[model samples]
Target: MTLKHGPIKNLDMEGMTMIFAVAKPEILKTLKVGDKVTFEADRVKGRLTVVTIAKSK
Candidate 1:
């Protein structure tokens, strides 16, 4: 799995979390809104957009 570092915009009931990174959209497309992901950021560096999230059990 590729390691990505970015700012997490939002986290919903779904498993997915919206993230803002310098990475290209194509790379972002690969990630599902509800897919479990890991990121790193110091502060909010971007806008939070709506994303499909997975329900947590």
Candidate 2:
């Protein structure tokens, strides 16, 4: 999946770090820690970080 908004925090050869806010629970479920992802926020386009994953159980 692609993220439409977020701030690019850190980056490396392997991947990048992104800090974005999401509202949909369904979308959050599809993500996991260390998972590779794509970011698309306004003019920014590149890989992102699944640095952390939080869910309600």
Candidate 3:
């Protein structure tokens, strides 16, 4: 799914919108299109992957 996220400072990336494959698709069931979230992503097998997610405070 596409996520509109701010800069991932840890990754040294600037803010932008992009597509991300979720590590746990089940987590999608708990999220809505516009919900603010904090997540961690990594390059797995040459793909940008969302490894963890949580509702933003």
Give the top-scoring candidate (lDDT). 3
Local accuracy of candidate 2 as per-residue lDDT tens digits, 1-57: 333333444532333343544433465676676555554232234433343444424
Model 2 residue 41 lDDT score = 32
Worst-scoring 10-residue span by lDDT in model 3: 6-15
Please list all clashing residue pairs in model 3, or write none if there are none. Answer: none
Name the regions of candidate 2 deviating beyond 4 angstroms: 1-18, 42-57
Worst 10 residues of 1 by lDDT: 47-56
lDDT of 3 by residue, 1-57 (tens): 788888887677888999988888987778888899989988788788898998888
Per-prediction TM-score to the true structure, in the order listed = 0.28, 0.33, 0.84
lDDT score of model 2? 0.42
Ranking by TM-score: 3, 2, 1
* lDDT values for all models: 0.38, 0.42, 0.85
User: Roughly what TM-score does model 1 have, to 2 decimal places?
Assistant: 0.28
Better structure of 1 and 2 per lDDT: 2
Instruction: Enumerate clash totals for all models, in the order shown.
Output: 5, 0, 0
lDDT score, candidate 3: 0.85
Q: Give RMSD (Å) of candidate 2 vs. truth.
A: 10.0
